[model samples]
Target: MVQTTATRLKNRLRRTDGQLQGILKMVDEGRDCQDILTQLAAVRSSVERIMGVVVAENVKRCITDDQLDTDQQAQLEAALELVVKNH
Candidate 1:
């Protein structure tokens, strides 16, 4: 993955991790259901965004890899299959 994209994704994941911890604390403290669900949805959206960045970077790599041979193509295909199968 490109450095900038990777950094961005990592930062997003860190935020999501914090959000998850907050959710846990909320559950432990018996917070309102609506607020908890809202935070949960935000975390889910952040995760989805991270997935999108990863897939986009992989697609870019596939398109721009000049040394891609038959073996590499097959590997790319398998990787793409795994990505597509998620969610």
Candidate 2:
């Protein structure tokens, strides 16, 4: 079965949550700082990936949506440009 974007994002978020829990456990157990930092990096990357997915989906929507007025389309394009530049 093909998973929708929402489903994919939810799964990614769950994995990120699990990574965070593991980091907490590592801290409690006095695990190596390097190991904890590695996990933290992984979680950060996961979150970034989620953000990219969301932005890509929104961009696609903006391009394909035909009902948007000219002003709304311009606003969305500007907002998307800002997000891309900041990201």
* Number of the top-ranking candidate, with lDDT as the measure: 2
Supply candidate 1's per-residue lDDT for 66: 71
**RMSD in angstroms, all models?**
6.3, 5.4
Model 2 Cα RMSD, 1 decimal: 5.4
- lDDT tens digits, residue span 15-77, model 2: 999999999999999999999999999888788778877896788676766878889878877
RMSD of 1: 6.3
Could you tell me the lDDT of residue 11 within candidate 2?
Answer: 97
* Cα misplacement distance, residue 4 of candidate 2 (Å): 1.0
Off by over 4 Å in 1: 1-3, 65-87
Give the poorly placed runs of model 2, Cα more than 4 Å off. 65-87
lDDT of 2 at 83: 63
By summed lDDT, the worst window of 10 consecutive residues in model 1 runs over 78-87
